[model samples]
Structures are given as structure tokens and as C-alpha cells.
Target: MSVVTGCASCGDERAAGAAFCESCGRTLATGTPPAAGADCPACGTTDAVGADGYCGHCGRLVVRPRDHAETAVATVAAAVTDRGLRHHRNEDAMWLAARDADVDAVVCDGVSASFDPDIASEVAVEAAGRVLASGVPADSPGGLAARVGAAIAVAGAAVAALASTGDPRRAASNPACTIVAACVRGREIGYGWVGDSRAYWIPDEGDAEQLTEDDSWAAHAIGLGIDPRAAAVDPRAHAITAWLGADAGPVEPHTATLRPEQPGLLVLCSDGLWNYLSDPVEFAATVRGAVRKESDLLRAARALTALANERGGADNITVVLVPIN
Candidate 1:
């Protein structure tokens, strides 16, 4: 008998039942399927999140720690990372923590074409998350935006510093990844991004808005004059123009802030999830439906990932959902 296995992040071949993708450094599955009918953490309802980890009543994702790996900082914030159907492993990572009235979250996607991209993603998120958790700098002149930018700088440096640790091939190819992060305080939110990962403001009663613009070929073409639909279909559409790695030039991070009129969700995600539902209105509706049903932020994040998988799951998916009530 012969078996063939391919990476979930990249289409590289791998040994059967491998624990990690050799091409991308993403974690592989042991062939065990995820469990279903888990209880909803918010409503104490069984099978609320369903087999896919999404709650029907609240439309949130109840983490089934058994079925797949997931994490949550509090009722207000949650994140989920998964290796989709086509990928053998997940090359994405996220970190989030709620501190009093403030919330910090980071999401990173490993560049499939780069060496040890998974390592770059993991390191970047850790460095950024740590900076966010450490509290804002009091002496800093720029405040939240500056702090967010600083976090991205720290993340970039961390990735760049890793170039010397591995083999020569690693230094040559250089692990690379895209990152998006946010620090929210009450009604005010500060966000930053490098590469194509994204952040959005999803309101409870209004239209959703994409906060950070993508740093990719498609976005650049759209800026010049190309129609969005046309630009997105190009061969270089998803190719990230900026990232954190040894080869990446000076990291030109983008920063922004917003204050919503009503309560909503502050969402951060990788291309894997957004590619399936790019329309802000449609994405917001899907999220609003889930949040209304479960009121559990974690379940909401999981539901988003599930939606991506249902839409072909061509790559690893990651999402962080934080309630802004």
C-alpha cells in the first residue's frame, strides 16, 4: 500500500502522519478527526458550537480542546488556528489577552514560499504579543499608534534575528511571515500590519469596515486604477509585498485607529479566512449572526475558521475575535 501526504500551507509532499510540515514548519495532524457536539462554554448548551465548533444559538465557536487546538484569554476575546482540508499542517499562529478594559491581540501567517516560515510566524507573534501585554509606554510620545508600531518593529527584529540560528539554507531563504495586531482600550483601538494579514471593525448594528489595507500586489494595483475584482484574480494577487524576515527590506508598517459608535467585534485574521469572505458587509453579517447566537467570543472566532474551511479550505486558517462591548 502507498500513501501520499501534502502540506496544508504549501503543496509540498510529506511522509505519512508527519507531525510537522517540512516545507513550512506547520504542525501536522495525526489523522484524528475533530470531535463534534461539544458543549457551549457561554450558554452551557450541548453541541452549541456544533461539530465545526460553532454555536448555533449564539453563533459563536465553542472551543473543543479535544477536536482541535484553540485558545482564549477571556469571554471577550478568543482565537482559533487550523490546518484546512488541503493543508497538512497549520502555518498560522495567534495570541490574545484581555487586561481590564484593554485587549491585545496578534495574528501571523507563515509565508509558504519562504524557509521555516512557521518559525518566523511563531516568533513574530510571541514578540508582538509580549510587547502588547507589557502595557503601553508612558514616556512614548505617540501613544497607542506608536506602541502598535513599536510592537511590529519588535516582531520584525525578532524574525530578522533568527536568521543566524539555523542552517545556511535558512539564512539564505529566511523564514518570513505577515503580521497584524491590535490594542483596544474601551472605545478606542489602535492597529498595525505588515504584509497581507488583516484587521477589521465589525459593528453590531452597522456595516463592517476593513481597518488595515493589505500590502500585496492586488492592493497596489487597485490603488493605481485596476478594478478590485480584476486585481484580486491576478496571479500575483495574494503575493505579499511586505513581511518580516531577513530578506525583507525596512519594514514599512501601516497603522490606524478607530472609535466605533456602537459595540462590535475587533477582528484580526490571515488570508486563509478572509479569502473566502472578502466582502466586509458579508463578513460582518456572518460574524454578527454568530456573536448574537453564542455571545461567546471564542466560539465566534471558531465559527469564522469553520466558514473558511467550508469554502474549500485551500490554506491554513486563523482568526481572533474580541468583543467590543
Candidate 2:
């Protein structure tokens, strides 16, 4: 049997004695045999590296898909997610679906402090996206707010369930994530969120506005009559008060509805983008400038992502844009 070894560069398995890795095409060090007890690349634990390329001690990956990703729906909507310069991996996920005048989108940012946070974000986005795209009846009594709320609940449940598995690490930290979801039908929009992920309405000719209130310490402090500047400077300002996780208690998502009288853009993003442009007016202008410069949804999304990186991407960035005409 040909012995199989993992490529250190890209983490793909390669047959022993192969000159190059088939996955990433990097030259392999086939001549020099691995030391008797090699240290794991991530955690530096002796002889604790697994054949699959993950560190047995720390479970760190050599590489992963979605380090950067882009998706589009004709010219109507687009989304981008990137690992950014600081993070070891991309822990943000987004989903976009558009049909005619209807669109459904979701964005989730993993809690870095939690184990397997990437999985939590991925599952939350998928669950919320599916619910948003379920084609809730137009004449339904509960209407879009209820639909959006239900999507958040489903996403929260999905993230919470990650702790139910046998992994003690998962139970300890309990994979967690923040979610923001939006659904657009004709000229009306419905949105909801948990944690700091945000949704903004940027009109073509008027002031822009943030649709969802953040469930974070800063916002709570501001509500309690603390000065905005004082609240923002606090170390706990960005610390989320609500999230999707087994330990997050009840997931009471904040939801709202919007009916724009003029043409605009609906923006959904993780903190990576907003951290640099928290002002609604600046965020709207930047997005508008990108759309005008690129004249394409996918390219505009990419431009926004590039701008975030240029500004020192301290966290995973995710941006989703849906044009409302």
C-alpha cells in the first residue's frame, strides 16, 4: 500500500514519494523522512498531529475553504466573505437567494471565544437562509416580521444544538454565533438580528439608517443615558449581550420592518465591515461609491471586501448587498 501523508502547506493528503502535492501543486519533501516524533504544526505538541492534517492537540486546520468567497444573483444581489489578515481562518458565513422581485439573505459571524465557532456560523446562516427562502405566503397573517423572527429562532436553535454532541469541548464553550437576516419582497423589507451584526437601509438621495438595534454592551449603556463616546470607548462596548448558543439563554431576536419610498440599497454585514464604518451615512456612501465604480453587484461586493482588508482587517469580514428598485 502506498503510504499517504498530508501536505503541510495546504493540508491535502499526498501519496508518499510523490514529487508534488496533487491538491496545491507544491513541491513535496519526499526524500527527507518525517522525524520519529514530529511536533504538531499549530500547537507544537510532540507526535500529536493527525493524518488528516488537523492538530490533535489544538484541532487547528492547515487551511480551509471559504478563506474568500463570493456569490451573486444576476445583478440584483451579491455577497462576499473573507478570512481577513488577522484571523487564522474565516469564521463568517453568508447566504443569498433571489427570485424575481424577492430576495432572502443571511449573515453570521462566529464568536471567536467559542470552540468550532466556524461551524456555528455556517449552520446558523444555512438554517436562517432556508427559512427566509421558504416562500412564506404573501397574505400570511403574521406577516414578514413574524417570518423574520422565526428564521432567527431556527438559526439560534441550530447553533445551540452544536453543544448536544459528544464533544466535551463543544459543551464547554458551546459553539456560538451572531446572525442578521433580511428578506425583500417588492418595495418592502423585513430584517432581524441577534448580537452586533447589522442591517442598514441606504437610500439613493437621502439619509441612511440602521434598521436593527445592536444587542451589545455599548448600545445598552447608551440606552441607560451614558454618553455615546464614553460607552463606545469601554472595552466591553462591542461585547455582545445576546447570541445564538446553548448558554445564550432565550434568543429574543430584534426585528423590524421597512417600506422605502425611494430606490435604495439594503446592506447586511458583520462587524468586520462596520467596525471601520459604523456611521450609517459613511457606510451608505462607501457602498454607493463601490456600486457606482464597479457597476456590478459582484464586483461591488468585492470592492467593499477589499476596502475592509486595506483598512486592516482585524476580523473576518462579510458583506451582502441587495438593490431595492
Give the Å shift of residue 232 in candidate 2.
1.2
- Clashes per candidate (backbone, < 3 Å): 16, 0
lDDT of 1 by residue, 50-97 (tens): 656567788775443322446565565777778777765567877655
Q: Encode model 2's per-residue lDDT on 184-271: one tens digit a residue.
A: 8899898899999999999989999999889999999999999999999999999999999999998789888899999999999999
Worst 10 residues of 1 by lDDT: 25-34
By TM-score, how accurate is candidate 1? 0.78
Candidate 2, which ten residues in sequence have the lowest lDDT sum? Answer: 25-34
Candidate 1 positional error at 240, Å: 1.0
- Estimated TM-score for each candidate: 0.78, 0.82
